[model samples]
Target: MDELARRSFVAAVLGAVFFGGPAVAQNTTAGGVTRVALKGYDPVSYFTDGVPQQGSAEFTFAFDDTTYWFKSAEHRTTFAADPEHYAPQFDGFCAVLLSRGRKVEADPEAWTINNGKLYVFSGKRGVLSFNERPIDIAQRAGENLKQLR
Candidate 1:
């Protein structure tokens, strides 16, 4: 198999062995009203502040059918200008799990910026796994995301 395909297979096997099965689906919306992205963490903070900051409801914006909270009005404006640039990949789902074709919720605190894009993970393991072979995992995750959509 090619390198990407080989990594994908290994990821799937590891996921099965470690997680015992497919990851649980993430909840997109609460009360079917507002869908909070990044669990209320400001997406912009990952890039600008270099840390995850809890956002205030006072500064919120809706994009791609999800409501994103911001640390400040300026951050909200920045996100509104180009949401795709700020939003986490895999719809805020765990990047490592997505490479394994699983849709799992991500922890905003566990994240990284690769190629100027934001990627969030489920926890420490997810972060470490993604860091190992980011390009391969990201490519695989992108393909899996298309299938999921």
Candidate 2:
């Protein structure tokens, strides 16, 4: 294979092992069972590809950490141009918890998106619990965030 192809192949393998599938390939069954699992925090950070960009209808940060290969400088630049439109809510924390007067970190394994908003949880257990009644959890979370500020 050519050099570029070889490099891409290597990158893809590493990506699957480390970052899981492409950001779009993330699993949302429940219990934060995403491909990767983050340390110091829940697995959702790994599943959602490390939060999303808010505001401008994008999904990634402008200046993403080099840990994940974003594919282009322009992609990063676009994220930088207007981050509020792209940054994930609560830095990829558990949206349910955030709306519920708490600040629980997320596990990348359990994740989902509703109307462009990413919701992450601790793991398969967490995802299943959240899925039992997403609306109620979401509503409570919304009320909780309102009290924060």
Runs of candidate 2 exceeding 4 Å displacement: 1-74, 81-86
Error of 2 at 38 (Å): 7.9
List the lowest-lDDT window of 10 residues for candidate 2. Answer: 60-69
lDDT of 2 by residue, 68-87 (tens): 22334344344333333433
Q: Global CA lDDT of candidate 2, please?
A: 0.46
Candidate 1 weakest lDDT stretch, 10 residues? 21-30
Question: Of the candidates shown, which would achieve the greatest lDDT relative to the real structure?
Answer: 1
lDDT of every predicted structure (CA atoms) = 0.78, 0.46
